[model samples]
Target: MTQGASGRDGGNSLKARVKTAKSRTLASTLWLQRQLNDPYVARAKREGYRSRAAYKLIEIDERAHLLKPGQKIVDLGAAPGGWSQVAAAKIGADKPKGEAKGKVFAIDLLEMAPMPGVEFRQMDFLDPAAPQLLREWLGGPADVVLSDMAANATGHKKTDQLRIIGLVELAAEFACEILGPGGAFLAKVLQGGTDTALLARLKRDFAQVKHIKPPASRSGSSELYVLATGFRGRREATGEDGAG
Candidate 1:
């Protein structure tokens, strides 16, 4: 078989999976037998979340309390927007209660239809102009920046890890650019853990940078999220701003 352009040979390859299949249950067979059969998938359907991943945000927020009415937020890599949905619901972005107004700016390379009180932007976040557009939309800095953007990984392991790290770094830098004092940043990272420099940078900027794997996240997945809260709003935190 030819290697994919990204060099990540799809996941687990169909042949390897078939070779291992034997007396698996129907549930296992159908799930990626047709799709991923996670119990959370079933629960998400009943609970009305866009995807099972929504619960991950809920679990993280349960401890952090990042969501609030009237806070401005930016959701990066927000296609099939599960996190944006939760932010909207919690912040009254869905219904707009009196004096309680919030907006979730959802951005992705892929197109999403639309969500009320959520601003959708289909653009490469790497674009130099994207931040300005977002700032204009929010009318200033934001209270939160959430990123779930992982590059389409090639099964090659190290390359994929590096790519994801790069994305995380970009998100962190962007968070620093746009977050107000006491702002928070949430991002996905791998089990090998975040790079030391990245971790160190977060620690210096936020009050605390902690790794959390929410209960709603599948036990089998190696993914974990880094929650960095309480932006110091200092010069060091805004290095990318070039105010030096």
Candidate 2:
């Protein structure tokens, strides 16, 4: 792939985009620096993935084999559709009729460019009506529910963590409501002795619960992924939004 100035291809993979010197603030400069030098960012563009976040899903899938031919998947907070793209491909979402026809249903607040094998809904996952709409579209339970959903960062540390935790909790509730028996759920989490309670709940719900820090995640980052598998079907009388 011929990488351009924006680093959209594999050619010159490690080269950084040169930026003009300006009177920008220190934080802005640092952010620009990080973006310019991020190899994963460049590689993601080259591979035509929506974002570098795609590789995190790839790493975990390599470990868990959650995406199978003809499997149905729900991509929570799949803005820009990177994870959705990966899941869609893994599940054989695109093919000639009756040829391993898998499905990927992705929901997010941000508009995303189209990707093959992905059916997208541009709406906030937090909307009260969102889950209903998703269910109507899915027509039944799904094989996997994956969440890369994150609350918009407010910069304050504790608040940001809490906000993301809330999103993760909501995703879990959605998973319990809709994931098929023996299904899987995955979420991005910040590591720091946080999310222990959430982890405990996940352990109770699934046969296996483990955490992974994928190589595609930035080294300076505190993010890790939680993988929960073998979902025990929810009992009757459980609410549509279960234990959010």
Error of 2 at 4 (Å): 13
Give me the displacement of residue 126 in model 1, in angstroms. 1.1
Per-residue lDDT of 103-178 in model 2, one digit per residue for the tens? 8998877787777788888877767777667767877788899998767778788988998887788889878777
Per-residue lDDT, model 2, residue 213, is: 89
Error of 1 at 57 (Å): 0.3
Model 1: how far is 176 from its true place, Å?
1.0
Q: How well is each residue in 65-165 modelled by candidate 1, as lDDT tens digits?
A: 88988899999999898889998887888884454488889999999878767889999888888888888999988999999777776767777778888
TM-score between candidate 1 and the true structure: 0.81
Which residue pairs collide in model 2, if any?
A: none
Least well predicted 10-residue stretch by lDDT in candidate 1: 1-10
When summed lDDT is taken over every stretch of 10 residues in candidate 2, the lowest stretch is 235-244
Per-candidate alpha-carbon RMSD to the true structure = 9.4, 4.2
